[model samples]
Target: MDDVAKGQNLDDFLINLADGLSRAQSRLNRYPVMNAVGQQSMVYHIPRLEFELKLQMTAAETPASSGSGGRLPLQKKSRVQFLPVKASQHQSSSSATSIIKGVFVATPLDATVSQVRLSLSVEKKAARKAQVNVAVIAAPGRSVQGATVELNIDRELSERLNKTPLKPSTRLEQASLILNQESVASAGLIIANQEPEGQIIALIADLFGQTQTLLYRFEQG
Candidate 1:
């Protein structure tokens, strides 16, 4: 920044920097945020407005559209800084030793990027309501009591923490229960079933300050 503001007075530079920081803060304040899941992988929602604008810009920059004036660049960018997930925090009930922090990336469907494969076979409780079951093991050789589970059919599973005693209307989206080897926690909720690939299912198990999260792509039958 100092290089870019060459020859500028120190006082003027400080004022400009402060103004820029303030604008950034204001932008963050305008966007709705879900930070309860900060313990695990942080999930951020790039405003739909930005997502849509990005699409328009992509179209404008394409080879066929070069003759037309390109879309103006956006001043701000949204990013997700993926932190290294510590193994001790996430325990997976499925393939116990197979994944770290309960989240695993499946092999690539094509040749380039790896992704988690979407799955189906959910037992439907009613129209638009799909039932999901998850087994949680907070600790080994210990009573899995006092553990709670939260889940929902969201575009991003790790979006937020669902509170217990959720409006009866949304009871199935989140639930609490004693977890154990023989016990399973389940959540059922009415859904849009939007994408062609399937909806994402996120389940979180929290006990004694330990958290386990699973991000699964769920396909509708």
Candidate 2:
């Protein structure tokens, strides 16, 4: 009887163990099974370079000519250089800015002058190239007492100014200025160049009757 009882207990234990394993398997089956397909990952990127063109303008003092009995010619000095800027995803195009500083000499005939204006033109070679003029001052300010002025250039704005035709006389008279006593003045400008590598020539004029040109060369990145 002891042997028989032992046998019966062993059978019961085996049956319980089998039932527990079946239950566990069933629970696992209820949960979703995931399989790894051919593993794949993808990424896309675009590279670009950022650059800036800086221009500075100042008054050029010519030496007194011996023939003119110590009289000097009024000339201006200008310079341009390129500056590398950090790349940004938001900036898609290259741009330029000019900072101009100078002095205005007043004469006896400049009493009627009450305002001053500044204009900019972008050229390629010797021909006038139409570019976007972001800020072209048709009439800058009523005070011609010699102060700072700013101009801007871009593709969109230049197209508009090109469409509006002006006579040669009007264009020539654009930056004429009357003499004033104040010697301190300043100006600024911004421009955009679409080409990746080339030369850009900029001509700037002020109502103070002075004009200056700047040249720049660029290379591919």
Candidate 3:
């Protein structure tokens, strides 16, 4: 199908799905039996990603044989992984681009959860066409080997239609996050580290390559 036809079909589907869900929720709320049966709950959306990070720690100590009993102070160090998803849009061969901050973690307890935003200005330089696939490594806070990670791409949440094998022209466009699930957890060796931020960086490195030269700015709110 052509681009216009595809766009129309996608819009219709989304509208119908939203309407159906709304009706179902209303019916469930109005029925006392259904409400008591726990069917009155509404489906909520959370922005999340599946990520993992490998960390190395080190410490310094005094000799055990020292009878002087001098200061036995200790020290520590760590490494981290980071993957940030920002809202983006692309005009059909336009010069300027617009970006809306995408919400990452939205929970009832911490409704004021902080978010990380990124803005990249792509210059008119020659870059080879490449495809990047982001994945999550499940780490459930401990060694439970053989854990798996997944990525979920939501076209509506982040704006812009889904397109695979995107072609880059002179126009700079915004990219959407391909998330793993509503919430992300780590398992196995990764969980042993207990480092959420570090894992995010590692996952991004695996998908987008080295970060030595990548320009990144972190905003907290």
Candidate 4:
């Protein structure tokens, strides 16, 4: 689809999306169930890459480690798994939650949560191609790990990339990375010759019972 049509579709789609979320938020307010999180998930629709970051509350009752609204903490482990599901089969919030099941691991109540900046660079290889470079800068004496990096590309563009042996995709059908001080994550892309849209990348640091979450998005269009 062209840019104009895509924009039109997105506009129309948001109408339903807003209304649905409004209703869902009401239900969530009425029933703050399992997830002991501020926001269970923040969804992005690049026509359904379906990236979901969920915070769930467990009643294990060990200690109040990490929870919102005076809830208890969990002792679960962090897990990352990739599953390929057809868009047609993705129908409900339950299914969406199932998509990215274990996004965050357990954290200690005393562990502090803070925001730190990381470097993201894009070098143009051609009008239709570029290399994405990501760097995580930390305090000279501190340690940082690129726990997770999410990149949102057009759905069709992503599929095309898969056929050409691009880097592995996340459960969100895009890119997820694990980078350390000694390594970085870089990839080249050609989005049908388009200059590429602003990407929505999440940098999660899940070391030492702390979770540093960053949501950054930019689009050329």
Q: Write the per-residue lDDT of candidate 3 for residues 36-85, one digit (tens) a residue.
A: 43222232332342222222211222223433465554332222211122
lDDT, candidate 3, equals 0.26
Give the Cα error of residue 169 in candidate 3, in Å.
65
| Model 3 misplaced stretches (Cα beyond 4 Å) | 34-221
Per-candidate TM equals: 0.30, 0.19, 0.16, 0.29
lDDT of 2 by residue, 138-193 (tens): 23344444343332222232233243322222122123233334433323222233
Top candidate, metric TM-score:
1
Task: Assess each prediction's global lDDT (C-alpha) against the native.
Answer: 0.38, 0.31, 0.26, 0.39
Candidate 2: segments with Cα more than 4 A from true spot: 1-146, 150-193, 219-221
- Residue lDDT tens for model 4, 25-121: 4333322222233222333222222224332211221232456665655555333222334555544433332323312222334424423344556
Give model 3's TM-score versus the native structure: 0.16
